[model samples]
Target: MALVAVVIPTYNESENIGGILNALSSLAGSAGLNIHVLVVDDNSVDGTVEIVEDFGRRTGFVSILRRPGKLGLGSAYVDGFRWCLRNLGDFAVAVEMDADGSHDPAQLPRLVEPILKGEVDVVIGSRYVKGGAWRGGRLSRRIISRGANLLVRLTVGLRVRDATSGYRAISKKVLEQAFSGERSYETGYIFQVETLYQYYLLGARILEVPISFYERAGGKSKLGPGELVSFAAWCFRQLAGRISGRVI
Candidate 1:
């Protein structure tokens, strides 16, 4: 069986980590998937690491990398991908997901199947696609999310509908090429856009699998005004780079 490493970057998510791990465990067992979860934590003081440690001890399916401080999400995932590549060398797929219960663990199979079948190099659990729905976000938040995605699509000419969606899976080749040598420009949520844009530039086959995205059931949201500003700046930079004939 091909191993799948689910890289979940977390911060202060003690309440939700256990449930997310448990759901993944159940899904892996029922589906007979060789799924290993790598939880990259940013020194969450909320006992998030303790929960993951306990769960890891119990199931032995989850392992964690504890950082010294709360680094940005992009760096967290990059670290996770590097760890997976070095540690679980046989893992064929790497999945990027949230630890705050916004992304349903049940939809993992839908996100991963395409890559396993070689149908696409990346699979996005998209909220803007058909059969997908966004639930529990406030009107302003919804507008910001939609507007940001649209702006990226127009500016970068990215083909994916939900460029900001983090619920996605990538094949090993895609992961290595996406993170090879260069660091992501946006450190926070905007990293999502940067990663997807890199994949698009690499000419990876990308597919969107419709998914229902719920608001976080516990803990605080990581998105903030700073991330929004960073996103806008990154978009403009990409536009400028494109105009200058420098492929970003």
Candidate 2:
């Protein structure tokens, strides 16, 4: 059976994991696809593993990876990608989504469609697209979002809409090509843009599906003010490296 693994990296998402798993399970059953849900928990002290394990037992399609600690989002995804590739082999499609339901599980099928049909290498659940929106947060967030997107575009020279969007569908081949070895990628939100750019450099076709970007129902966001600053700094460094043709 063909498999698509949605790798959800959780820090302390006890309240949301159950619902997220259920949504994925329902989506899988409806589509008749062998959907594997991999939850890469960053050693949440709030019994996140137990919750995931219980769901895994009930669903039989869920898997849990207990990481050391609160590693950054990018590293969590990298580790999840490796785990999926190693276990699922060519049957895996690497998908990244927030555990807090910010990215609707209903939209998953749309993201996976192009890859399932062998038409694209990666599919991004884009918020900056025509049909997407930000549900909450302040006015400054919009400015920050635009600024980050602009920085990424100027730096990477790619025309992707949602630079920092976590919701993405990636074919195994594309994952292997983009993350073959440490490709100068940092472990943060900017990692999404970096990965997208890496795919672009490797000549992979990326499709962006419009998504309704919602706020997390339970937990607080990890991408706080400080992380955004660091993300901007990383973008400038990456920009310089890309322009100078340095090893990035």
lDDT of 1 by residue, 23-102 (tens): 99999988878999999999999999999999999889999999999889988998999898889989889999999899
Residues 1-248, candidate 2: write the lDDT tens digits: 57898999999988788888888889888987789888999989877799999988886889998989888988888888888877877565778999987888988988988998999999999888898888886777678778888888887677888878889999989888776576656788778887887788788899988998877788767878878888888778877887789846
- How many clashes (backbone atoms < 3 Å, residues ≥3 apart in a chain or on different chains) does model 1 have? 0
- Give the alpha-carbon lDDT of every model: 0.90, 0.85
The candidate that wins on TM-score is 1
Alpha carbon lDDT at 149, candidate 1: 91
**Superposing every Cα of model 1 onto the true structure, what RMSD results?**
1.2
Among all windows of 10 consecutive residues in model 2, the one with the lowest summed lDDT is: 177-186
In model 1, which regions exceed 4 Å deviation? 180-185
